[model samples]
Target chain A: MYPNNLKYSKEHEWVDLESKKIGITHYAQESLGDVVFVELPEVGAEFEVGDSLGVVESVKAVSDVYSPVSGKVTAVNEALLDNPELINQDPYGEGWIVEMEITGGEEDLLSAEEYERLIKEE
Target chain B: MSQLKRTPLYENHVKAGAKIVDFAGFAMPVQYTGIIEEHNTVRNQAGLFDVSHMGEIEIKGKDAGKFIQKLITNNLEKIEPEKVLYSPVCYEDGGTVDDLLVYCHNWEHFWLVVNASNTEKDLDWFNKHLKDEQVTIENISDNIALLALQGPRAQEILQLLTTFDLNEIRPFRFKSIDIAGVDCLVSRTGYTGEDGFEIYLASDKACFIWETLLEKGKGYGLAPIGLGARDTLRFEAGLPLYGHELSPEITPLEAGLGFFVDLKSEHDFIGRKALEEQRAQGIPRKKVGLEMLERGIPREGYPVQKDGKEIGYITSGSPSPTLGKHLGMALIQSSEAEIGNEVEVIIRNRAVKAQIIKTPFYKKEDK
Candidate 1:
């Protein structure tokens, strides 16, 4: 089950509104396989919702990590530089990818129950 | 849209929780547990792979040897019966049709194992060039199933079911033997750059053989590997994959597969003239090994640059599980491809520094 009380995007990204933390969901990490490298956006960068923010390289393929909400990038996770497998080990806690100041309010985001329902439908 | 094809081991892949992807129109397992794990398993211990999708062609005729010599680039006259020879099946323009293994059963019969994606095209090419040739070509891709058990411990695990001496089949040699009392063709050859065997049996018995191997090989740290690890294993060993390293537009010379081409052979073969001409004129571009100087794992189709000018492109690349480093092979101008020369690879729109290194990032220790 996905963590509750977090806004979820259909793209399998989760946001903790209180701390402005964002990371890919457990389902995303599972589907992506073992993460070999993580390329994060520099702090102070601005992006619209659903913008391509960075990339995650796995042993098999490279995938773009998209921003789920519009925001000004405040901090990017540096822990993943040396230990990208943190995303696979703990997708929600130690795997948080970025912190941002919300410039555009949450819109069309789903709750945990809705996100779980959506994934089941897939 | 057409439906994706599945091998006889499709059900087994699903039961094992494999991540299936569409590879060359076939729904194949790209990874099971994980790519890095499965890759290391083959490097240190042993691993099993479902290579049933590879196409096999059987040639039965009095002129089978002559027919083979005319088609592929490698010389078959010197290849002994019961031995296997690797060849780059080339086109008239010197471009590679596919890199395949020719199993010389005898003068009257030969077997060709070709790339699965190139099966239809290869068959068409073979038939088109018959030109009154006295040989019968049969497509056995669907009837035959293949499983490769590879690693240092491969012999011990496979010896459990067969009483025949596995040592009889030397590297690049094959023997028609019985396993678990079932008739099968066993070959002492593998693509993983390790000591192993390739078992070719009836399609119906594929699942049974696969399960049996996994069950018998469990104690030896054998795991079911997928295409993800398969690519990594072959890349680390500097073996060329058909589409990535050799293709219709990529010549064997540029791919560094000339050893298998037999350019100086007396036999007249397809693509011989073109390759000879290319060799005399000096190959413009060639393949070289690359080790990442900066961070970032290089991926295929990415550009390679020298002094900010695009010079080449990565043919095959990944995080080498065995070497524990980011490395790749690139096709660049022969002049710029010298070993130890520095080049930059474009990874995710950023240029990452990489140095050309000696090929074959990993090699198996001699027995």
Candidate 2:
């Protein structure tokens, strides 16, 4: 379910406005199959849009989680380090990866309607 | 990106909500419910697999036995009809051409079951070496379909299908029998290191047998497994995948498969000279098992190091679902392959500490 409240990125990541939290989308989790390990960026790490912030490893392969918006890592998801399958079970809620103070790249985000259309075209 | 081939059971996998991926030019299912769960099913209960992508070649003639004697590494003097032999076909330089199973029916006819990806190359190699032998070879891969039922409960599930005494066939032996009304060549052999059978039948009859097995096996806790769990199961069992453990750059002896290589046989096979030479000179590299001492999952192609110098690389690695440990197999220098030797796996530019441990990671308790 693509929620209307969150803005989605072309890389299959979603961002929440009120909580300033970031997480992968449902499509991402489904495509990854099963998440076995998570590598989170250090707290206070600064990065720009398109920079790799963390990593998600599945049973067969590994994928990089890219930053959709430029910001400093305010908080990290410690729970994912122990239980990475949270990303596959609930990618939008408890599966949130990091929280940050939005700095730039706001125009690059797409609405839920536009993101749905983009995935359809893919 | 080219047109991928599909097995006969492709539609069945799609209908069961499987994640399809390209495997050796075939559109194959990589997972069904999940890899870990499916892996567990085969260890604790029973699981079915559509291994139709494997290649089967038939050789029949007066010289069929003698022709294969020069092609494979293992000695066939002790072989009999209805028996299977696992051996590696090598090149002139002692590198691996492929690892395959030879199903011996008699002196005049035999079947070679090879890896799916190596089918074309193996066929070409087999043809190129044909000297004045009376052997006639044919590729029967497309006409046949293979299905494996493997696990602790595999025997119980398969016994309900056929009236033939399944107990009559021993491990590494095959018998032609009627299964659910279809005639099939069933072998009590598998790659999962369990008590199981690999059934070979007509291509058209694959779907019917698949459905019937799943239907009847419902009460026995049988589930459909995919390539993902198939790989993990084989890896945890310490089986060598062709491309990973044995390859064109790797020899069977270096991969720790010296048991299958017969160096003292009177008949000289391909690569025998090189293998003998290597044996005389001492094998330079050895395959060893690595267990992570620090946090991090080792993966294929990762560099292995000792004292800041690159020693070798990981051929295959993953989190063992059955053993619940981060494990890997590496082809490193033989001097550094001793048990309890400390090493490092360079993951993402960081060296993760690991220790050399006894291989196979997991073994089934004796029944």
Candidate 3:
């Protein structure tokens, strides 16, 4: 499990600010079940808050990954194409779906504690 | 609304941490660990399932055989004592009322296991039709608990506990025997396309049998399975479910179950006339298998399009655990129901390319 140092989205995606690179949290992967396939946005693709950025498909169903904040995708997780199970194994660390360059400061995102509480309510 | 019905194993499922869901007016476990894992366990090893909610009806009398022959599509004359035959009970209009397993114990005693949701309808159909026959139809579903132990190692695990020579029992064969000091009826039948057995016992004895099997088969890798994997496994095997593939609006011939319909028999069945007429005219629609050729996966109720026109709808769809491919069964027009034909499945409002393929998408090799 990843540490509670990053902001999270209600859709289960997490944003960790480490030298400007943002990644998904561990909670996202567990909720998504086994990640058989993932479709991430192309690098350099601009996105606004709530924009559909990608899709994560499990054996049961497919869920869309949305942009938590307005930004441009800097890099996509290329390793997910062959071994999507990495998301289930290491969600917050090596299984991040995309690295985005934040165009603006996080305003609508929930803090680590708030996101944890939100998941509990769910 | 009132709370949904619970089976005898409801508490057991909850104690085992199964995620419960509403199914056919019953609160049942959809998955224990996960659907994919439980499905693979059943395919490679063995898994136990709680199917106590399935409806069982008993018919006994001198005319029981004669009466059931006219009720279902399968020819009763071919079935001997201790043999179970799977068939669909159809309406006079050639539409399927329900798919059931008819167990012939002797010349005068038989049992029919039907879908849980169709219990009331099946009982009424039997009572209405058998009024003139010298038979008694009784709905014994509430009194019986059905447990299915399915997979490759199912027979070996079950044989260890029972005095009955299970190896002598061939497929679709069943016998009443004493196991764990309790008299129960065991059948070598399953829906998962695996070599397995289904046991019917008193509701009080269900927990004992379940616990005994788990304790005895621990070394063989037996896990408690749930309805989630059951659906995916059956879907991968191209088995037709009542509401999805076999419905009141669909005939068995159209649902790719013609093998179970014995038209060659001279016995007059309920839908024999309409079935013969349909056979002569050729089936209007046929159930075909679909494999996704594009990136997206299809789901139930999704529209199947061919050349920009809707030709069919997917009845059951899922990512196959054994094959690792997205597969589905679609009820398509007979003209478009050919293997290798290209079709498009509308998934998430996008048309994804798919191809018509032969059923049983995942084949199990001989053990």
Candidate 4:
């Protein structure tokens, strides 16, 4: 279920409204099946709204995780390097991939209701 | 180009919350519950699989055995009725046509279970090779459906549904028995490297048999497995999938299946001359297993390098669910495939360190 407080990208990533934290949505993790490994960007890395931030590897395939908004990465969840299944277990809370200092492109993200509609259409 | 085919258990898979995907032009379940969990279940407890999409060809006639023996690289003379033999049918150039299982009923009757994607092609190839031999090859793919019950607890779970003595069917042997009133050809065979049985029955009875097995084996932790875990299990067991390990471009000998090829036998198989010539001239490449010493996961099509030079590419790779180690199989230059040799696998264009290791990453202790 899409939470009401988070802003989501069309690419199935979510950015927290208050904390500016980024992670994949529950729908994204479910589609990826079992998460075996995840590659996170460094803290100092700067990226545009559509730039790829990292990768999530499953047993069968690999998918790229893209940044939802333009910003500089302030912190990354290092625990995911050892326990990537956390993404599948808890995609919204403890499985958060990175926290960023927002710079621009916040207006492009969809609200929870809008994100829910978008996934249903897909 | 046409609509994808569906097996009899397609609705059952959907009702079980399976993720359906296109496999060999058939709408098949990739997973249900999850891949790693289903994989571990098959290794430890019991798992059921609806493999009805696999192709079945019945060869019947007085020359059936001789005709098949001339087509495959393995010696079938060693096997008798109720025995199963695995072999690779090859092209005259020594390349693989397809690897299949031959279930023998007698010298004049046998069933060939082949890969789904190669059904039409295999039929054409077999017909093309038909000369003066008194053999009639009929494609019975639509008439037969396959179900596999695999794991350490398979026998105990399956025994609950039938009164037949499963112990009488030893490894590589089969029996015609009745399970829940459905007549079935039950074979002590599996691809997961676990103790299991592959049941062949009428296509119409597939869903009934599948449901009965699940209901009866539920107490034993029997879950329906999908194609996702099936690949990982077979890869971990070092069993070759057609497109990856054996193909028209890759031979059984090069794929490290030389034991299945008979080079000195009196029968002149289709590819015997070419395989013998390769043996005499020395095989150029070989399949080897690799374990990652670095972070990146080795994946199929990733370039394998040694001493900064490209040697080969990963054919099949994944994390071994049972062992919890990242492992892969690669076909590399034979000279560079020595055990203990460190190699580099290019992951996302970055070289990651790995080492050659002995294959069959997950082996059952009882075997």
TM-score of 2: 0.98
Please give, for residues B20-125, the per-residue lDDT of candidate 2 as tens digits.
9999999999999999999999999999999999999999999998999899999887578999989999999999999999999889999999999999999999
Q: What is the overall TM-score of model 1 with all chains considered together? A: 0.98
**Top-lDDT structure, candidate number:** 4
Q: Give lDDT per model, in order.
A: 0.91, 0.93, 0.87, 0.94
Candidate 3, position A28, lDDT: 67
For every model in order, the TM-score on chain A comes to 0.96, 0.97, 0.90, 0.98
Better of 1 and 4 by DockQ: 1
Q: Write model 1 residue lDDT over B1-367, tens digit each, in one string.
A: 1398889999999999999998877889999999999999999899999999999999989888889899999889768888999999989999999989999888889999999999999999999999777899999999999999999999999999899999999989999988987899999988898899999999999999999999999999999999999889999999999989899899999999888878675899999999999999999899999999998887789999999999999999899888889999899989998889999999877899999999888999998
Per-residue lDDT tens digits for candidate 4, residues A81-104, read 999999999999989999999999
Candidate 4 local lDDT, B1-367, one digit each (tens): 1498999889999999999999999999999999999999999899999999999999999999989998899999879999999999999989999999999999999999999999999999999999999999999999999999999999999899889989999999999999999999999999999999999999999999999899989999999999999999999999999999889999899999999999767988998888998889999999999999999888989999998899999999999888888999999999998999999999988999999999888789974
Please give the ranking of all candidate structures by lDDT, highest first, separated by commas.
4, 2, 1, 3
What TM-score would candidate 4 get against the native?
0.98
Assess each model's interface with DockQ, reporting 2 decimals per model: 0.89, 0.75, 0.44, 0.87
Off by over 4 Å in 1: none
Quick one: how many clashes does candidate 2 have?
A: 0
Candidate 2 ranges with C-alpha deviation above 4 Å:
none
Clashing pairs in 3: none
